[model samples]
Target: MTDEEVTEQVREDAEEQAEDAEAETETEDHLGPTSTKLVAEVATQDANLATELEGHLAQLEADREEARERADELESKLKRKQADFQNYKKRAKKRQEQMKDRATEDLVENLLDVRDNLVRAVEDDHENVESLKEGVEMTLKELDRVFEGENVEAIDPDPGTETDPQRHEVMMQVESDQPEGTVADVYQPGYEMGEKVLRAAQVTVSDGE
Candidate 1:
């Protein structure tokens, strides 16, 4: 219990307290710096992920743009083909009409000489009656043969037969014992070529009074 012993004990107590405070400060420093570094690294990793997502999104947009362009190109091609087909159809229809016109022209050309000969014989100014009559008859036969070959038929309605306006051009009206609209007499013959009419027959119609 001397003063030296008391002072040594106090020194030992003070040194123990200093050691505890230093240990606590060291722990706080280590934890604070390491946690801050860890937080920064996590933020950097999140930034990298965001950059990758942005790149993927840009790639998707580019792909969509290319797809749209391809679709537009296909639509243009379809329109062009459709336009070409329309033009082709128009040309084909025009060609058919032209061919029909050409055929009609050839037919008229071939009949011109026969028509002229008939005209010459019909003038009635020549003195030779018998030869002119024979020439006229021969020309008529040639015309009939031509008409027959072309499927032209003469309409000759019989007495008391039903009259039709399609084949007969009424020339006269007669009062008779026959039924209404009956053909009484046919004055001129009508000619037909297939389903088409070349001429209408002149006829007299009879109606019961």
Candidate 2:
């Protein structure tokens, strides 16, 4: 071959060798180094995701714990309130009972003076039966004043009035000019406070005329 032809063939062979080296370098970057880098990047992302999930789980646990504490606090408050209400009811009931007892004691204390007056009237000496009766009447008047102050009244049903089972007790049945089931006579007067009869009037009931 001539010298110029040999030189041209050398130039072409050098270009082909350079292209093959570039292709080998590109293949190594794409299949070997780039694939390893991609796998490393994926591993890093997975680790970060796992860490984030752990953080979320911890936060959820904290929230649940806070909710539990709140529930316990409310329950405790409810129990305390219930206990307070029960105590208040008990105190009120005790106070009511005390008031009732005090009222009864006061009434009895007021009646003691009447008893004393009656005793004095009975024990004192008198000039005649009329004087003795007048002393007893005075004692009865004082007793009536006390009863009036205490809202107590005498149940002294008049003769010929209708007999009431709630306020009168029949002592005996007797024939009278009045209608049947009427009061013939009041043997003993009754005592009452408000609408409650302390003692029913003892009376003789009339039979049919």
Candidate 3:
């Protein structure tokens, strides 16, 4: 071959190779922007999802904290109520004891005057047995007055009256001119206050003889 022909062929081949390289570069450039855009969108979606998840987690934490606070408030209220009830019970018991003591003190104070009169009667000298008996009767009348003021009644059943098991205690069965199962005589008078029997009447029952 000739030297000129060889040089021309080499130039043609170099030009075709440069044209192929340019086409490939153009194709890469066209695809590059779309691929980069898709990657960027995916990254943006992941970031939004992470932010939403963080928000949900924060709300859940807030709700849990509120519930804990409510429970603590309820527990505190229960403790306060229990303490109040215990204190009320103690106060009620103390008041009851004080009332009982006051009642006893008042009763003793009233009985003191009656005791003084009895002592004076015993210490005084009487001219005769009748005078002594009169003094004793007066003292007994005073005692009866005191008993009446206190609402204490005597449970002395009359002869031939019906025997009361609630207020009368049968001391002995006696042959008497009265109905059977009836009170013959009251041996000892009983005392009662209000609805309560302080002492039952000791009595004898008739045998209908």
Please state the error at residue 185 of candidate 2 in Å: 2.6
TM-score of model 1 vs. true structure: 0.59
lDDT by residue for model 2 over 99-125, one digit each (tens)? 999988988898898898889888998
Please tell me which model should have the higher TM-score, number 1 or number 2.
Answer: 2
TM-score winner among the candidates? 3
Per-residue lDDT value at 170 in model 3: 98
lDDT of 1 by residue, 51-169 (tens): 99999999999999999999999999999999999999999999999999997886777577679879888875877889898878878887777667667799888878887778889
Quote model 3's TM-score. 0.63
| Alpha carbon RMSD to native, model 3 | 8.1
- lDDT at residue 69 of model 2 (Cα atoms): 100
Task: For each of the candidates, give the backbone clash count.
Answer: 0, 0, 0
lDDT (10s digit) by residue, model 3, range 67-171? 999999999999999999999999999999999999788777777877887887889988898988888888888788878877999999899999989999999
Can you give the lDDT of residue 39 in candidate 1?
A: 100
Candidate 2 lDDT: 0.92
CA lDDT of each candidate? Answer: 0.87, 0.92, 0.93
**Where is model 2 more than 4 Å wrong at Cα?**
1-67
